[model samples]
Target: MSVTPHVVPGQYREVSDANGRVYRVGETDRSLLGRPRAWMVWLPWIAMMGVSVYEYGYSSAEAVLEHAHGWTLTETFWIASIWAVFQAGVAFPAGRLRETGVLPARTAMLAGAVFSGLGFLALSHLSNPYVVIAGYSVLGGTGAGLVYATCINMVGKWYPDNKGARTGFVNGGFAYGTLPLIFVFNYWFHPSNYKMVLDLIALGMVLVVAFCGMFFRDPPKSWWPHDVDPLNRGVSEDARRVAKRLAKNPPAKGQFTPMEAIRTGQLPLMWFALVCIGGVSLFGINFQVPFAKSLGFGPLVAASSAGVLAVVNGVGRAIVGWLSDYLGRRQTLGLVLVVAGLAQFGVLWSGQAHNEPLFLIFAFLNGFGGGAFYPLFAALTPDYFGENNNAQNYGLVYSAKLVGGVGGGGVAAGVVAAWGYAGAYYLAGGIAFLSALITVFLRQPGAPRRSGDGSPVAEVGGRTPSPAEATT
Candidate 1:
């Protein structure tokens, strides 16, 4: 008996046999969209951000301690750098673990939250600097790494089409978390009972951890919203056929391993871009508070400025996210780097003048530049590589920022000690300018497609049909 094949409109594919009956191959309305389980995924991120904000209080405390206990600048720098190192080291492996499915996203998130709480709790009681460094820097850094990697990975998966926007939203949460803590710590702490402040931080971490644990969940593959269907349709049949015919087939679904990604040229280029941006941004964020203080601003003013910077940072991420969806990734990134370079130099000029309004403008511009870079890096990775290994890829790329945190922060402190704050500002501005130069070398990974149009339709086992035929 002979058989014939017929394609139906928005329904099952019909293959007819000589007997006059048909068999279906493709589903009529199988959903292709990916929706996350209701808001549960976001909770873990929000909790982690809260803990990060609480951790910033320690820096605020450091400023206080400098005056109260006569702690040296070296001591403060070491504490912060050590913490950044710990976060850098742990983030990649934690990402690898999540990518391999050894730990569920929620479970890892809970562990991070709990560990951070305990670290803060230890900080509250310790009198020795070594113990404070070990408990808060090392332990807290590890926990932060875990929480950050997992939250970013989940968000990337949840919004496959708009990785930048989703990651920007998550990063923004970290910034927002700082606002509340600024008020809380100021209202709660007293000059006489310094130890009580640590206890309060520990309590806050515990509550955040518990709330995250209760609510967080890894989005199931089937959870995508129905409305997003048009975006996630798998590659064209022709592409799949070509992929299948290759000597080495594309990695299995959810099987693009991290080890393989590192070997590709794309990874190194991506890493370089991240390092350039991360290095400059971290230096600015870590030193902005101290720099403000050195310029004759009181602790209250300095701390308040940091809080404002945090808000501006969040706004930067959101703006970049929206821009990435419209402009190709590489072009948008190049533009951001250019703006950041200008802002960094602006800071140099503003710091020397000692003009308040000019200083604030430069500060906000600098914040906008540094803040916007991270979300772009986060979104760029999965767009180049498939989502299968998103956690590991992002983790590896994120290490650049961690390195920047240490190098940039350390360099700024050393420069400030020798040349004064003006010199340090000049040095950072140079680095930001260099980073912008590097951005021009980066290119989009794939060919250009229609603007703001994500879906690319192709024919099954044949050339892509015309749009008129595709619609019919």
Candidate 2:
């Protein structure tokens, strides 16, 4: 049973497994050097780290940016909110182009690198709020979005056989890579040298992304590990182990186009849940440090708390991702949201009591849940919708963050001004709980969406089709 690809120049070829099932293959991992490449993982991973500072890394620097630019809290938040809009907005279009081969992975990375530099520069040199918003939010957001979407998609494509652990590892970088940067902003950063520091960071983004982007690429359609027998492990123990783990979470029956996925109705459900989850996360990112300060905590404690958030946020993504492989994506997601939602109350209590240790502990959990949901959705989109159009499907889901970002930043500011931190935290907790409740309804799209009585929706025929039924 030797499996071979029938290469028909310029079009998708065919490959059949031992089961006699046929697969359509597009561009594959075949390179001059070999079949498998480790750099495929490391490069996209490093590129994720490069663009990460754009979103998750901004809180510690927010105060300095506010002071350096002579802006009020509302104005500063507006800038951040706008950045979120553009960052999440660009994902689908950028991903569409990337998938169509109009914008290759390497090209997207290079462009993102340059845009990221100019975004930081906009803050350093521009004085007008309007000017800063356009320069940083539009340009920087798009740049970072392009890089972020590309990196996450790459992992899903490359590791289709086991997306959980790897996708989580890469996504974790987006949260924690700014670990050293957080400390820098805290201990050494000042208004006088802010411009110099930003310029350096801008340059660093270029160098790091450029280096990694050069190696980035996507796997062909219906691609699986070349040596692993997905249907039958035969005598290869490694393949057996790999296949066994992946058996729990199988790929979509077929590659779905973006429009087709939308028709399935899962995308909108994901969008709404993310809107709530992302808002809570971003609110924590933007206001948690300031909240600590408002409680009369020392600057060191404030900075340390933010740092703990970042480290735990990043580490939790990896841990949860690995955990999802065993627990399943939906279960892991529900747990994460529950923890995050409850932690908001803990954080609020710690602040009221001015309990430093309690605040730090809850901060760690907050960070953990804040970032974990992202990779879950990232992994889930392809799982439900199929991997071929993952970029577009995921882009639609990720775009919810724009709404969340606005609510978290500017809207949260208003919440603070109105009902105070207690009200805001209570609201955030409730949102997280709602998001968890939503996760409970998530079923494989092609499967029947269940009713309150546990009866299947008539059209879905009651369950996920077996892989055999899914295959054309």
Candidate 3:
């Protein structure tokens, strides 16, 4: 006897052959995509990316202050380092809240946005270093942490099948969003009246957050696309039938609980990969402006250069995401890491040469690696672990990056203080290479399975089930 999957009004039903392992009759709904809910979930993703850009802009503003206002290098490093630490501190709690469904994802994101906007607003007023620390470092940092954790978590849940692509796109948004701000700040502010510049940045952040809030929403239980299938292939027909019946009765409830995932081994490996990439990438991103200044670029040039890196970062993410969809996630990542390591070395060499064009080229290459690394990890994690606990797992992984940023930023600053800019860039490059080396140890979670005829089925289930499945 052979069984076919079918969809019914309230439940899924399937029959088994005499050999229980083979399903003879099954009802599987095919409408997981093309639902109103999928688009709804995507809104927050785009918004989160936008907010990430705002954060980069905020940090860039600090670089401007360091150069124009004569703020010490220690002052700049302390502010940025504290901000990253605050982000790390809040990550786990926010993830827990998301996992428990204590707050709607959009609400959390909006709250974070408001805090971020306010931080910039407050920053515009303060002249003292302590005030800058209080506003941007503590308050602003806290807000960024909350917003980032919520946004990435939501994306992971919404696009389980294409976790790599979806997460890459969202993460890419952060790098890309910086482009507009780069132009905006360059046009809006000059060193003569830096206070006015702060006010404008604050105002801009307010507008950006408000615009994002309009569209952000949590995906409904039934919001998946129609074509994608669930990856849990071994789920028995009876279990699926029971789940369908339950889903129909309480249509908004999730089938899997978060606690179940925390108990699994996959979460640890996923967390490890995320942290490793984040650690290396943040080290570069947070220090780019300072690194440029050390190389004899003035404040405006340094800030502009940082913006240029942001552009390359965005492009790298888009390319890597596209490739991840075609090539396997692990394979693409392995190759990217290797290339990133070499780029880091180039940056170190270019800094020693003191050639502006070489510095720009190396910066682009290094930024490309940094930009590509995170999104790939974002996509890969969901591939290994189920989406149910994505927020929690990603939050934990991000912490590693935050920790790395704290150390890396301070170390980069110290290197500049002692040996000059070339030494700092060299050190950063060495660290990136070390991170690339670690990628060699990554293995795809499962061995490939073959059909009776020995054909290979591509890996699926890293993203969310489509709309058709939810309705069925």
Candidate 4:
């Protein structure tokens, strides 16, 4: 297909109803690309994968990296913690700029490519821990965060109808993308030649994020699928199903700005819940393999445990996202949280019993529950808050991961030091349980109020209310 610079951008438009719900519509990126085989979705997926190795593959090389730089384990973990901080910290601001059209998604990602490259170079050349933290954590983290927020937001905008599936699929990339890097670090990487390896990884990040990000863009806020009509009948079966889901869980009554979302009372709840869940998940990422190693498990068992966690973590995301379409996002979230909490104890059980097979089995369960909640959270942000300000809104919610990173990594270290792995695991399990209980109160703040006839409506105009019509 020939690309044309002369092709005009779509005009801004809105759809409204008397109940006062409004939707902003913009052209889909698929149309802009001349609908060339869903490249919009594929690009973000690849970009997500490209950035994944930085976070997921790091643990495998921790010992070599520490030896190369002569840093204590705590110092190394702090760098990882700080990296998480910067990575998550940038999401909100980036999302805000992207939504306001001040920072285009493509530009943000290209910048990420540059930052990511610099981060790797720093790791290769810098011997000082503090300087490495600044370079690897701040620079690398920001770069990864930019690509992450953009890729996540990009897919959400394009596939609002089946967002769960799309989000899950894209999110899955972040996990499994590190598979090859994990193998490389485990078997082939050595301190003697580590600089060259870091350079090569840096080079790969640049290529993937830059190439894929070039195609990145968003559907206009409030953009609805052109083929799916909520008020119309005789649409395709898929369209009908999507429409029904929308009715069951309506779009935001209005496109709320970030401050407006905060006032709704649910944002804080979501944040805290995610903080707990995120911390638990990160702890699993950081310590699960090491814990297995301490259990007299063989090298194969230890490596397999980590690999299973990473792979299953990703695969479960896609599976659950598909499940959420039927089960509902909140309900699915609670279910996953429960399982994740139980898995913590199960891992401890397997460790105490020195059950290698059992340990691996819990590792699988832990991995599944660990990541399945991510796409659900991503989907719920839009479902509850609306897509117009989703970048910023979701940014606020995702920022919980910053605090979570601190808890899961640095704070977890202190916990392990004082209480040992078994004690730390129990505490983590308790946090997960609390988060699951919190998921119970996750109703949308903008849901329509019921009238006398049991029809749901909002007082958009502040006029005298009429008798409610019957509703399903």
For 59-96, candidate 4 gives per-residue lDDT tens digits of 77787898999988788778888999999999999998
Model 3 stretches with alpha carbons more than 4 Å out: 1-42, 53-55, 67-70, 184-188, 219-224, 231-279, 297-304, 444-472
> Residue by residue across 388-432, what tens digits does model 2's lDDT show?
788888998999988998999889989988999999999999999
Cα lDDT, all candidates: 0.62, 0.80, 0.59, 0.81
* lDDT ranking of the models: 4, 2, 1, 3
Error of 2 at 450 (Å): 24
- Using all chains and alpha carbons, the TM-scores for the candidates as numbered come to 0.78, 0.89, 0.75, 0.90
Backbone collision count in every prediction? 4, 0, 37, 0
lDDT of 1 by residue, 386-443 (tens): 5657777778878876677676666657877898867766676777777777767754
**Backbone clashes in model 1, listed as residue pairs:** 34-224, 35-223, 35-224, 35-225
lDDT of 3 by residue, 1-472 (tens): 1223444423322221121211111222223323444553456556655556544564556556766656886777766777777776777778778767796666676777777776666566665778877887677777777777766666666654455556666666777677666655555555776677666655665566556655555443323322233322336685464334322221111222234334454445545554555555665676666566667866566666677678778767768876776676667787777676677667667766777778778778877887787777666655544455556656665666566656656555676689775565566656666666666675433322233743212111323334443222
Local error of candidate 1 at residue 313 (angstroms): 0.4
Tell me how candidate 1 scores on lDDT: 0.62
Error at 324, model 3, angstroms: 1.6
Better of 1 and 3 by TM-score: 1
Deviation in angstroms for 95 in model 1?
A: 1.3
RMSD to native, candidate 4: 6.2
